[model samples]
Target: MAATIRFLTARGVPVMAHVGLTPQAVNTFGGYRVQGLGDDAERIRRDAGAVTEAGAFSVVLEKVPEPLARAITAEIAIPTIGIGASPACDGQILVVDDVLGMFTEFRPKFVKRYAELGSEAEAAIGAYADDVRERRFPAAEHVYATASKAGDVA
Candidate 1:
């Protein structure tokens, strides 16, 4: 990861390093486990340092312990972005779907739903369907006047 970050940065590409609870490596880690816990703190610390030294402008710490996240943030010169990490990090990130309560396949422990837009959307569509079925839609006020040829209208 550090090597890739370095290569990208060397080519003038801004790199955002991702540490802890890497979703892509979920299989290797045996599931979505929080990283930087207990003895793993040292490893995570090293990872953060390596990433920063590799020229990453920011790093996302996911599902790491709050204290470890704080320490990593302090040790690194770049900004630390937390996902499931801690509020002490420099910043935070969340998926738009998670925030809007649209994607419900599985909810992470850290995600906080701000709105139930999915349910609202479904209700709205059902209402529209009912209106159309009852012939109550396309009411005169909801339609446009047909175009008239020149001089055809008085």
Candidate 2:
């Protein structure tokens, strides 16, 4: 991972390192569970430091304990972006779908939904389906007249 970070940074490509509950490794982790707990905290800390040393401009501390995130943020030279980590981080982020409440499959403990757009969208789609079934959608205004029907021919 450090080699990859170095390779990207050396080529002037900005790298943002993500440690603790990396989503791509969800299967390896068994699930979207909190990381940096007990013995694993040291590993996360080391990973953050390694990325920073390898020239990562920022690192995302995801689904780790607040204290661990805070400690890593203080120890690392790069900015720490938090997701499910605490306010102690340099910045915070949440998935846009989660914020809009559009993803109903799974809700994480840290997600604070700002709107219930999914339900509203479902309701709107249902209304449209009803309109189609009642033949109300193709009202006269929706029909287009062809040029030949209007007596124009080339």
Candidate 3:
């Protein structure tokens, strides 16, 4: 993360670090629960400090204890985007696919579904299959004879 930040900043790009309840740490967190994030808050504090020190322009806190998230955000010089962290944070982000309901089987607690893309796509595919089975497809322009009067080539 430090190396990536340095590389990006060198080229004038701003990088953001992610801390707390990181989905990559899902197994470690014992599955998508808000991190209690301890009273000492040392780990979160250190995380914020390191990201800022490493020259990241911002950091994100996801599903962390609200107080800890606020404290880290307050102490850190850069912005702290939050997801299920709290409104006190500088910004928020949501996964596009999740919000669009691409995966109806799973929905994160923080996301507000805007549409059922999964059902729509499934219905569309089902319709296409029905059309194919009913010989409703290949209307004129959709198919052509491979055979020619001169010869049938393989």
Candidate 4:
């Protein structure tokens, strides 16, 4: 991770480092849960230091204890972006689908839905399908005359 960050940042690419309860390592961590707890907090703190040392401008602190997040934020020179971590972070991020209620297969506890767009979309699609089935759509103004006609009836 640090190597990639160093390579990218050296090339003028701004990099954001991710640590604490990484989704890709969910299987290894025994599923999605809070990281940087108890003695492991120090490990997470060290990881954050390494990330910043690698030239990353920001680090994502995900599913970490609030105190640990605070410690890392204080220790690291770079900004900390939290997800499932608390207000101690410099910034916050959430999946767009989770925030908009578009993906509901499995809702995490941290996710706060701002709108039920999925249900709205389902209802709108149903209405559209019904309109098409009942021939309520494509009314007179929706169509145009054939090349053989000049504003005449079909």
Candidate 5:
């Protein structure tokens, strides 16, 4: 991972490392649960340190204890972006779907939905389906005249 980070940074490509509750490792972690608790905190700390040392411009600390996140943020030279972590982080981020309430499968504890776009989208789709079933769609304005009907054929 450090090699990859170094390679990217060496080429002037900015790298942001994600640690603690990495979504890609969800299955290995047994689910989307908070990481870096108790002894595990040390591992997260080391991961952040390694990434920073390897030239990461920033790191995301996700779903870890507040104190741990804060500690890592202070310890690291690069900025710390928090997701379900401490407010003390240099910046914060949340999944766009979660913010818009478009994803209903699972809601994480840290997600605070600002809008229920999923429900609105469902209602819209239902309305469109009803229109189609009732033959209300494909009204006169919806169809285009063929060349013969438009008297364009020689």
Candidate 6:
């Protein structure tokens, strides 16, 4: 916490430390499942306390028990950004692709699909290719000549 805060404060970037179901710990955490359930809640509380005490500007509690997350948020002076945690957080962030329906194989309930940029981009490229084949692009003055134009050599 202190180290995170110190670094962020010095660099002028907001701090967001992750705990509970951090992807880096996915194997130990048993996949991307929620954490802080059952007996683990207390441990989470302690961890959150330690983080807050250390002076972290903010924390990201991913895939944690909602109740425990809420409690941690209430206890901490700094903000908590819940990726898969709770609604009680100060703010939330989502990957544009996932929320926009780009990743259809996996989806979290909390994520709200914003757009379908994947499909949009694909269609745009297809249209551009078609235009190129039909000589729709590089019209007249759009391209340069190998040699100077009729009046250029003068």
Best by TM-score: 5
Assess each prediction's global lDDT (C-alpha) against the native.
Answer: 0.90, 0.93, 0.81, 0.90, 0.93, 0.77
Candidate 3 per-residue C-alpha lDDT over 35-77 given as tens digits, one digit per residue, 9 for 90 to 100: 7456536877787788788889899888777788888888989
RMSD of each: 5.7, 5.1, 5.9, 5.4, 5.0, 5.9
Candidate 3 colliding pairs? none
lDDT for model 3, please.
0.81
- lDDT, candidate 1, 69-116, per-residue tens: 999998999999999997989999998888999866778999999997
Report lDDT (Cα) of residue 138, candidate 4. Answer: 75
Write down the lDDT that model 2 would get.
0.93
Give the candidate number with the greatest lDDT. Answer: 2
Residue 124 local lDDT, model 2: 91
For residues 19-127, could you state the per-residue lDDT of candidate 4 as single tens digits?
A: 9989999999888888888888888998899989999999999999889999889989999999989999999999998889986688887788998798888889999
- lDDT pick, better of 2 and 6: 2
Cα error, candidate 3, residue 12 (Å): 4.5
Candidate 3 regions exceeding 4 Å error are 7-13, 129-154
List the candidates' TM-scores in order: 0.76, 0.83, 0.74, 0.78, 0.83, 0.68
Total backbone clashes of candidate 3, pairs 3 or more residues apart or in separate chains: 0
lDDT of 1 at 39: 93
Q: In candidate 5, which residue ranges exceed 4 Å CA deviation?
A: 129-154
Candidates in descending lDDT order: 2, 5, 1, 4, 3, 6
lDDT of 6 by residue, 1-154 (tens): 4566666667776656777777777889877777888999888888777777665678888878778888988998888888877687777767677777775668776667877666787788899999899989868776665776788743
Candidate 4: TM-score? 0.78
By TM-score, how accurate is candidate 3? 0.74
